[model samples]
Target: MEGGGGGGQELSTDNVKGIVLALLSSGFIGASFIIKKKGLRRAAVASGIRAGVGGYSYLLEPLWWVGMITMIVGEVANFVAYAFAPAVLVTPLGALSIIVSAGTFYPE
Candidate 1:
């Protein structure tokens, strides 16, 4: 598909880099979610209160903090990818990332 108002511009090297970055972002984000869940579970076990039940104990978990930082880095990577590539190319990669993450880590 041709991009709008660009005289049929094709994908460039930067677009390739963007795609790679987006994929890496997806991986990091997916892993971070898993890590954060583990931290939440640990916090709940230690405090005898689930985060869903208004527990703030997870905030003190170092693993949770690491996961949050991983997510932030992922987001930053995604943002940079967008800057280097078109939305049409980037959006599908994001969706694929979510699908892959779900398929890889989804509970039965």
Candidate 2:
């Protein structure tokens, strides 16, 4: 398929790889947020202080740490994906992932 505005240049394999990476990154990042939120809730219950109210107790929660690590991995994937594809193609896929994650986690 000839890419628009690229003088009939075909999409490279790297571009496909980038799109896949972007999708993976989005999924992980979304899961991380949900995990972190769950951890924060647990921390709040354990410590009697809500994280939203400036409680740092979630910092001690293992689940929260796991979520942070997940987010980091997602970010790294996103960065690498960016290297393989144009931002125009990558960004939207990432956004879609976020939407999917949100809908999966919060069903209200």
For TM-score, the strongest prediction is 2
**Cα lDDT computed for each candidate against the true fold:** 0.84, 0.88
Candidate 1 per-residue lDDT, tens place, 1-108, comes to: 645776776769999999998998888888788878888988998999999989999999999999899889988988999998888887778765566456665342
For each candidate, how many residue pairs have backbone atoms clashing (under 3 Å)? 0, 0
lDDT of 1: 0.84
Model 2 stretches astray by more than 4 angstroms: 1-10, 106-108
**For candidate 2, what is the lDDT?**
0.88
Instruction: Write candidate 2's Cα lDDT for 1-108 as tens digits.
Output: 544575766679999999999999998998998888889888999999998888999999999999999999999999999999999989888886568566775431
Clashing pairs in 1: none
